[model samples]
Target chain A: MKRYTVTIGDITHVVDLQPLNDAEHYRVWVDGQVYDVALSEAPDHEPQVHPHPSTEAIPSASPAAARDRPADTATEPADLRAPMPGVILEVNVEPGAEVQRGDQVLVLEAMKMKNAIRSPRSGIVAEVLVRPGQSVNYDEPLLRYRQG
Target chain B: MNLLDTLLAGLLSLSWGQVVMMGIGGLLIYLAIAKEYEPVLLLPIGAGAILANLPLSPLVGDDGLLTILYNAGVGNEMFPLLIFVGIGAMTDFGPLLEQPHMLLMGAAGQFGIFGTLFLALLLGFDINEAASIGIIGAIDGPTSIYVSNQLAPHLLGPIAVVAYSYMSLVPIIQPPIMRALVSRRQRLIRMPYSQRPVSRRTRILFPIIVTAVVGLLVPMAIPLIGMLMLGNLMKEAGVVERLVGASSNEIANAVTLFLGLAIGATMRAEAFLRPQTLLILLLGIFAFGLDTAAGLVFARLLRWVVRGPLNPLIGAAGISAFPMAARVVQRVAQEEDFENFLLMHAMGANTAGQIASVVAGGVVLALFAAR
Candidate 1:
């Protein structure tokens, strides 16, 4: 068994790893907590697991829950998310507004400094979810663009 | 009758010069309390100045508070080095490591130190004195005090004042120079921040490598650079959070109070009232302006050589003033084009300048120490 310390954010966890019978699996002890984890061949190649046909009959209305309902909702990738936590100082785009890639979508004020959040791709603004003076957290979707 | 006579004698002993010196102290206190100009140092220094010059005050006499503090640290170069530990603990070198080319701007920023040294030499100051005075261009308080105390102990008060005053005035002094050198078009150039994640291993190694390299090259700089890098290493190791907090906050604060008071006590009228003091003040400003201009000019030259969106304004951030220099660069760029965010790039250059300034200080010591 080999010990390694990993820090996630402000917390540090000391992990002890011991290889099992197979080369691909290991028994890990993290801060006295035990977990059995398997090493994957291709970590970046995410296997798409399709849902049951009966579950796909009615699509979930919430777009944010992509992990739970990945069939139809995950395909809509035009949502521009806030890159950092800040107050929305200004919303430069409105609903139905045409925008190009690299266009300034909104202004965010964090730590008394202003940052310009730009659009990811060219599309029509289908919805502006954030308003001026509204605070937003990191990775929170600020606006959605209509599919071409 | 004897008590009344003693009171009269004490009142009579107070000179016009002492009164003026006390007023200067009051002004410094007012600036610290009211204007908030470097309150940590200025407050103690101001109070020390008052105590040192008072009629028969025991604060600065033999074995007094101010005298003992001066002997304990400022005189022997302990305070500044201790303060360096705090500075290192507080500084994040991630930006500088991400972009190593910013090191050139840091080196270029030291032009003012040499330029001012030459000017001071011409103005009748000795080579040692001139070099100490020139280090005010470093835009670093502890480094300035450390170098000047060693080279020219008499000129410590004026040099420290000039270094800090200009450091606080970074926003005001640097903007005009930046605008003058880089046109609105160049300032508007958006250098997109490429997030090159620095590994934890690299962060841990950085301070160690820097210390060995700098120490081997310029042995005189070992004290300042070594302490600084030691603080940085502890911060990156992640095992010493309590030590880091204490070094950056508590120790730094305590040292600042003592260092400031000791430096202030040295400013008695006999030593401080010379015509050379005024000259040093002017030369100090001249050196700072030269450093800024040199950094801007060097950045413009780099833009010509490098094929990319380079904002020459960020070059001005290559002084040792830390985050302030970077912030000024960002503000200047934003004024011309709000969409342009040069803060990350400026920070890279700013941190690079911090290391470069220490190196320059070491180089200065080497040059003088050889003689």
Candidate 2:
């Protein structure tokens, strides 16, 4: 059995597929509900193994060596997404600006109608990814925010 | 004494039918002012009805201003076409472009026009007359006038009034049918919004291409579609802002006043009180309901094939009431789910309905002319 995830609209569901003896029929479970889906292509299941030897034998004697490890990061990045596709007529917030919920962040012009994009939550603006007069695709991130 | 007695006797000779018509006119005025249903049109219509029905009013006589306005605009098919220019300028085709598939819904909605035509034919109207009456189902005023002017001029006044009246009632009439046809689950389906930016070049090319394609296919549609596309072209070209503004605002308002009054004046008691006029009204409602049902059913079929959030109610906005029907769809969707915003998608289908109604009008003319 193999598992896959599918997202439709805004809802996500995990699906499981089990191969049947007939080779054409696959038993699929979507969000715990089973469905019969046919396979149109052969499944690929081979896993590739890396052949590099370990390099941990070289020991470091420096006192600050433990602090140089890369995997101990604590902060999660903020996600900022565009509400609709349109030319970014203006960006009202800049990096490090503290914003409250419902603050106007950008203006999007679609179908000749101007729409003001507002902040979903309060935070400090961390980065602005677009500029004025730039056309943006739907759902493209226009800016990111982090805790002040 | 002899001359004064004769004049008084003439004034008293007015019939009860005319008096009743005057009262109906007053009622129309009240509805226009108090109820505020299409005040731009209904006010003038009500006023004209009152003036024309007065015992000795000269407003509807051969040389009167009302009659002259009628001859200048309605008789020559000038007002409706000019109004089309305004409609063309005001409409935005972005929604329709985002979902080209919704064009089919517009086509399905037009079943109302044909369905009403068939029913009118069965009710003893000749083919030409039936076509004009049937066009009232399009829920479009210009198309109604255009087709009726070409096919059956006599039915124009009643059909236009019926079409506009039913369009105003779309919010009331459409909800029941929409509720009955769609389930709660269907209404709650939230479609993810996906759209590609339509280039300015494409926007400029659209009106020209549509004019050529539709006009070549149905030459009879040239006047209605031609004027309509011309207005749209002016707006989209970006250089004719003045023309677009004038056509959408000044010309449209002026023509609406004249068109409404002219249509109202035609409702003289003797001409409008016939059983046939009542039948036209009833059939008009049937046509609108049928159009809405057809669009809903078609949308359901599309839903089966496509996995997304498409509210079936948006299909009902596929009539030519423009943003009004679209707004009604948004309201209905909000009732079902407060956060669901179906306005953009519904506007797309609504604009398609406007164009489709014009094509359907042309098709009707071509079909009749061929026979």
Candidate 3:
């Protein structure tokens, strides 16, 4: 397992990449939450790992993340949250679907307008948490991503 | 027997002109009921027209219900202003605030207003009357009524009707123009949604700043913009829930009914049935079309100038028909590319269009008032 810190915009994320069967799929830890990610292509550069500066360690288990995950270790995954309260109008992807950043994953109808919810990063969809016509609230788990 | 004869005298006194006006009222009622075109306003207007046209009807005579309502609100221009308060309460300016450049699209959309004004002039309409007729291009019902009521009171009925009827027909009227103006390649241009957080402080200050800026620049617009901003202030303040509720629902509904009835009451056959009315109707549609085209062309120019891709369809939302024009733009763009989502961006232009239309109305008033 190799840990790398990534920053986009103003938010910083610490991602731990664990190679599963091969270099193509990785078990990624964001903050303390685990996500299975499928790489669209092999990495050209090696991941840079650094020692924990402080004596305090990363939280052993993120309670919210652990509580939401099912007990199956084989299917440990990550989820996307709803941006706002709305009804799911369309789910554009299914399990095992590959998407790039900015690709629409689903559509949420809010304020009588349809808003496209996009993929935050390039990855494969592992599971869809909601179906069309289902009502969802702000920050509700929408779907999960996995590395192939 | 004497009392019955006296009561029946009203029915016996009906004129052919009044009967024709009643038939026109029926047509409006049918359009409202069957076609669902601005039914809230049209239905009340239709019923008022019939009531006023009745021989010796108490509803339209001195101190009668329609006359009283007209004098109390419509004639004095209170009803439309009250309706603006409701509109302001309901409107969300966040979209426009996030994308301030959409203000240009809003300004471009008013091109039709001026273009139609010139045409009305060529058609031999006096400057004041033509200006009132041109306001229909704004696609804003309350603004149209407010401007026409001030500049050309006699033209109010037809102008209000044309403005609203075309507004309801936006779905039908805009698509063809939108399709023809831009190539398919341009239509498929994708504009992804990007969320920009607007702070509460900014939201609270928006209405106040707009009121001062617009009020100073166009003093004629103060009454309309002032009431609209007042409602918006109450909503954003979050302390006046009851006021917001009443303004958006109860007061709006009440004023709409009064305004519609008063305007309809003015449509006695002798007043409404004229070649000028027909010309006004034609010119109204022309103004609407010109606005749509101008907005599209301006957006096309923007796409060339701006670095990012902007679906020109968003420009069509600049016609100030509120959510309807914006929705039509979204639907048209989606037809070409289902993955494309321009709703938030289109709404930005739409809200900008609303502001621009109000400003344009004030300008028209200013120009005519100058003389």
Per-model DockQ against the true two-chain complex = 0.02, 0.08, 0.05
| Candidate 2 lDDT tens digits, B126-232 | 99988988888788988898888779877776787788778778888898888889876577555556666788898888889989999999888888888998998
Highest-scoring model, TM-score: 3
Instruction: Report the C-alpha lDDT of model 1 over B124-164, residue by residue, as the tens digit.
Output: 99999999999998889999999998888989988887787
lDDT of each: 0.80, 0.76, 0.82
Give interface RMSD, per candidate. 17.6, 11.1, 12.5
Q: After superposition, which runs of candidate 2 have C-alpha atoms over 4 Å from their true positions? A: A1-148, B6-10, B307-309, B369-371
TM-scores for chain A, candidates in order? 0.49, 0.48, 0.50
Recovered fraction of real interface contacts per model = 0.00, 0.12, 0.02
Chain A of candidate 1 scores what in TM-score? 0.49
Per residue, candidate 3 scores C-alpha lDDT tens digits across B1-371 of 88998979987788988998888888889999999998999888888889999898888889899999999998888999999999999988888888899999999999999999999999999999999999998889999998998899999988988898889899999999999998776776655345677888888899999989999999998888899889988998899999999999999999999988998898888878889999999999999999999999999989878765577888899978998888899889767544445677888899899988999888888889676
- The backbone clash count of each candidate, in order, is 0, 1, 6
How does candidate 3 score on lDDT? 0.82
Q: Positional deviation of B357 in candidate 1, in angstroms?
A: 0.7
Q: Which tens-of-lDDT digit does each residue in A1-148 have in candidate 2?
A: 6543333453333445687887667787755678775544323522221111010111332324312321101112254566456699989999989987557888777555556676645679989999999998766878887743
In angstroms, the error of model 1 at A22 is: 73
- What TM-score would chain B receive for each of the candidates shown? 0.98, 0.96, 0.97
Error of 1 at B151 (Å): 0.5
- Alpha carbon deviation, residue B183, candidate 1 (Å): 0.9
Candidate 1, residues A1-148: lDDT per residue as tens digits? 6543332322233445688998667787766789876655544544343221111222333324322332222222458776545699999989999987568899888534677777745679999998999988655779998876
